[model samples]
Target: MATLEIKEVAKRYGDRTVLHDINLTLASGEFLSLLGPSGCGKTTLLRIIAGFEHPDGGQVRVDGQDITALPANRRQMGMVFQAYSLFPNMTAEENVRFGLRVRKVDAAEQSRRVLELLELVGLANHAAKYPHQLSGGQQQRVALARALAIRPSLLLLDEPLSALDAKVRVQLREEIRRIQRETGITTVFVTHDQEEALSISDRVAVMYEGRMVQVGAPAAIYQEPTHPFVAQFIGISSRLPARVVDADQGVITVLDRALHTPRARGLQPDVALHLYLRPEGVQLQAVNGKDPQSAVLQGTVRESTFFGAVTRLRVELDGGQGVLADLSTHEALQLPIGIRVHVSWQPDAMRLLPAELPI
Candidate 1:
C-alpha cells in the first residue's frame, strides 16, 4: 500500500563495490522482483532496501518519506528469509502474536490479530503446534503470518520458498501471491530463479554484477531483451552470428541467409551482431513451405530427448552450429532421428544484440 523508491543507491564493503547506482521504483501495491545469479548482489540490494544495511549513497523512500538513516526496526518493514526463522519454543499462535506483543498491543487485540493472520495463511488449525511439529512449508506459513502481524508498510521476501520441496514450493508461491494481493502490501522479492521471478512479479529488475541489466515486464524482458547478457541470463535461447546487410530496411544476414532485422533503428552494415532465437520459436519443416519471405536453415537432428509433456531436439547446422527445439510429445512423435529438417522462425521473434559482450 506504499510506494518504494531507491534512487541512485550505491553500497560498498571496504574497497569492493557491491552495488552500483541501483535505481528502481515500486508503485503502491506493486510486486517487484530483484532477480540475478548468486553473488550478484541481489540479496545485498534487498538488505539495503530493508534498512538492514545502509547504502553509501542515494536514498530509500517509503511513501515519499526518506528512511535512509532509519534503523531496521524503525523502518516498519516485514522481512521473510529463505530459512523459516521461527521460535522453536513458541506455538504457531504465540509466534504470530510476538510482533503484536512487541508493539505493545492489548491482549484482546493481539489474540484477534493472531487468529486472523493464522486463518489468512490457512494455519488456524495448527496454531497450537510448535515449530518442530510442522513441516517446512507450514513453518514458512507461520513466518509469513508473523511478518503480517506487524502490518508493516513494505514486505521483503528473500527466497522465502527456497527451502521447501518442489510441490510445496509451487503451492506456497501461489499462496504468497494471493496473500500479497489480498493485503495490497507493496512487496520486494529477491530470487535467483528466473522462472520464479517471471511467473510471480508485476515487474522484474534483472541484475548482474551489482548493476541493473534490464527492468521490465516478464514478457518484454523475455521476448525482446536489449542486451546479450540479459538475453542469455533470462532464458534458454540460441545466439547466432549475423551481419547488418541493410541498415535502412532492417535486414541482417546469417550464414549468407538474409532475414529482416528486429527493429534495430540505428544498425550499420557489416557490423557484427547476434541473433537470438528461442527454441519454441523455431519450427521443424520436412520440406520447403509457402512462406517464401521467411528464412530457413537446414540442419540434421543430432539428438532428441523425450520429457513426458514435451520433447527436446538438438539440430546441428551445416556450419556445425547447434540450435535446440522444444516440441510437444505429439508433435515430436512425427519426427525421427537423423532427419534433415528446415528450422524456421517468425521475423519478429528474432532478437538482436551486439555480438561482443562486456565480460
Candidate 2:
C-alpha cells in the first residue's frame, strides 16, 4: 500500500555500532526480507523502520513523506513478533477487534471487520477459541489477522514463523505469502532462515556484522553472489585453492588444470586464489578418459551419503583437500569408498576470488 525508503540509516549503542549507512528501497506491495545471522542488525533495522527504535542518523520515508521522527503508534505500521502476543483472556474475534476498538471504531464496523478478518485467515470457525485452545499456527494466524485489522500502510514481521513446528512453519509461511498477496501490503520480513527468506521474499537483503553485503532476487543471490561473504553465507560451497595464471583473462590454475573464470578486480597473476564450487556444479566421472575442454581434478571417493533422490559424495583430492559432489542415487551407488574418480566442473560454474579476501 506504500513505498518505503531507508536512507543512510545508522545506529549505535555505547562503543559498538549496530547499523552502518544502510540504504534500501521497497516498491509498493513488494515483500522484502532482511536476512542475516544473529547480531547482524536486521532486527534493529526493522525496529527503526517501525519507529520502535530511533536511529542515530538518516531518514525513513513512506510515499515521500518523512516519518523518521514519528512515534511508533502514528507511523501506521503493523508489527507481528515471533511470539504470538495475544491476550490470553480474549477469544480470536475479540483479539482481532482490539485494534479497531482502540481506534474508537463503531461497534457494528468493528464486528464486521472482525468477522471479515477471521474469515480471511480461515479461522472464522474458531473465533470463539481462546489463546490456549489454538495451536501455534492458529495463534500466528490470529496475530496476523490482528495486524491487518488496522489496515496499516506497512507490515513488519520479525521472524513470525520461528516459534512454529517445521511442518506448521512451512504451512504458515505459505499462508502469510498468500495473505500478503491478497492484501498487497508492503511487508518487511526479518529472519535468519535462508530457506524461508528465499522461498517467500520478492527480494532478499543479506546482512553481515553491521552492513548489508548484498541484495537481490533469491535466484540471483543464490546463483551469482557478488561478495565472498555472500557466497559463503547464501549456501554451501567448497573452496579450492588455486593460483592466478592470468588476471586480465580471468585464468586460474587449480589441481594442475588451467581454467578461465570471470575477471576479479585487483587480482594479479601468480597470486593465490580461492575457487568456490557449489556441490551441484561438481560432477563425478570414472577415471577412464579426460575431456579436453573440461577442468578436472583426480580424487578418490572418501564417503557417500544417500539422500532420497540424490547422494552426496565427499571426494578427497590427491593433495588431501576435499570437495563435495552431488550425483543421482544410481550414479553415486556405482562409486563406493576408495573408488578413484575424476571431479570436474564448468569454468563458469565456479567463482574465483583472491585467497586473502576477508569474509
- The number of the candidate with the highest lDDT is 2
**lDDT, model 1:** 0.88
Clashes of 1: 0
Collision pairs in model 1: none
- Shift in Å, residue 284, candidate 2: 0.8
Q: What Cα-based lDDT does every candidate model obtain?
A: 0.88, 0.91
1-359 in candidate 1: lDDT tens per residue?
89999999999999999899889999999999899989889999999989889999999999999999999999888999999999999999999999899999999999999999999999999999999999999999999999989999999999998898889988998899999999999999999888889988999999988998899999998998987888999888987898888888877788778766546557877889888888887788664444433436878888999899989888898798888888897887777888877888866567878898754
Model 2 Cα shift for residue 253 (angstroms): 1.7
Tens-digit lDDT track of model 2 for 88-139: 9999999999999999999999999999989989999999999999999999
How many residue pairs clash per model?
A: 0, 0
After aligning candidate 1 to the native by TM-score, how far in Å is the CA of 129 from where it should be?
A: 0.5
Model 1 lowest lDDT segment of ten: 286-295
